[model samples]
Target: MNRRPLPQIVLGVVIVVVGVVGLLRAMGLVDLSLDDLFSTWWPLAIILVGLAALVAAPRAWIGPTLIVTVGLLFQLDNLDLLDVAVGELLWPLVIIFVGLSLLTNLGTRGTDDRTINSAVIWWGSARRTTSQQFEGGSLSAIMGGIEVDLRQAGLADGAEISVFTFWGGVEIKVPPTWRVQVSGLPVLGGWENKTVPPADPEAPVLTVHVTAIMGGVEIKAGD
Candidate 1:
């Protein structure tokens, strides 16, 4: 399973936002203080985290939706738009929600594969099938990730894959001796080919055509 850790990026972004707010307060740009913002807007943190998980976990949305709804309720209460002790009841409800989400995830059939003909991931992870002979295909990812493990796969001569990514990333791990070519335009993004050089000049070729906008595509040599 390609479990791309999501919390670090989200947490780093949250930290930067908090730091910026602190800087503005120090510069006397706004009258509010950090503690004040935290007390009133902390629920938003919960909502953002839930959104990240919902997008990256590839699970049903029921759990994330409930968590988002609860965060909204608490936000409204903190804003004095509602009269409720949601903060006091939040932790217990969160515990229960975690249990429910776990139960829901237990129903999905997770498998390992390496060959992909076509796949779309909006906010999750996609893995290619493990077939040794791989045919080119199409992949699309928006705010998600796609991982292809080609260590056991062989390329049909001139095999090609078209990949489109927006605000997301794609990682391909291939055998050390495969010949790979990556060509594409990266708008506010990048393409990295870190595969080891092939042992022979007559090795197979697999071309990856990528369109990355505010995202990245990385080709790495597999262990």
Candidate 2:
């Protein structure tokens, strides 16, 4: 039998043991609180499972570790170790780390395959408008050769927009009546803006801000 199958067997046994333990506790054979199950014991189980998965199938560790970490973070919030708001803020970091790890693994595996590497581009855009407010959002490719294009996405009269990219190129075309702020360091390419002016007092203007790392960015005036 392959060494990979051993991890699955071990995982199954561990889960069965947990189920049996829970049943025994519910029947008064063992005394355990929900707090104990969630805080101290659960994290240990997570670490153990993470190790097991890493040994059995390295590629599968990302999902299990992510689930375990998020579950533990929520448990910490419940136990008052972390503020709810702080926990919420940190949740994205956890996801980002997992995504980065997954990407790193994929990159390593695809190093010899240029086609796979070049297919990593992604693009997205959104717009919102109302009587008192206008909003627009977009995210494009990240570091590497990714490309994102957002054209005329934002509130009509007055708009607030934010764009984010990691290690990639992004281009946005906005109405000529919008104000723009570009911030952050691009590892490779510099930022460029065309026809962007200071805040306009008389004209209803849209505000656009972009954040990126190690990438090229271009923003242009449009209809």
Candidate 2 stretches greater than 4 Å from native: 1-133, 143-158, 196-200
Per-model TM against the reference? 0.48, 0.35
Which lDDT tens digits does candidate 2 get at residues 1-223?
A: 3232454467667779888888888899988775667555565554554444344323223333443566576556556787565456665855575465446435332212211111123333222122233333333343433332233333445344443344556566655765665443222345687855746666555444443434566777763
Model 1 steric clash total: 8
Strongest candidate by lDDT = 1
Worst 10 residues of 2 by lDDT: 110-119
Candidate 1 structure lDDT:
0.64
RMSD for all candidates, in order, please: 10.7, 19.1
For model 1, what is the error of residue 202's alpha carbon versus the real structure, in angstroms, after optimal superposition? 1.2
Model 2, residue 149: C-alpha shift (Å): 7.3
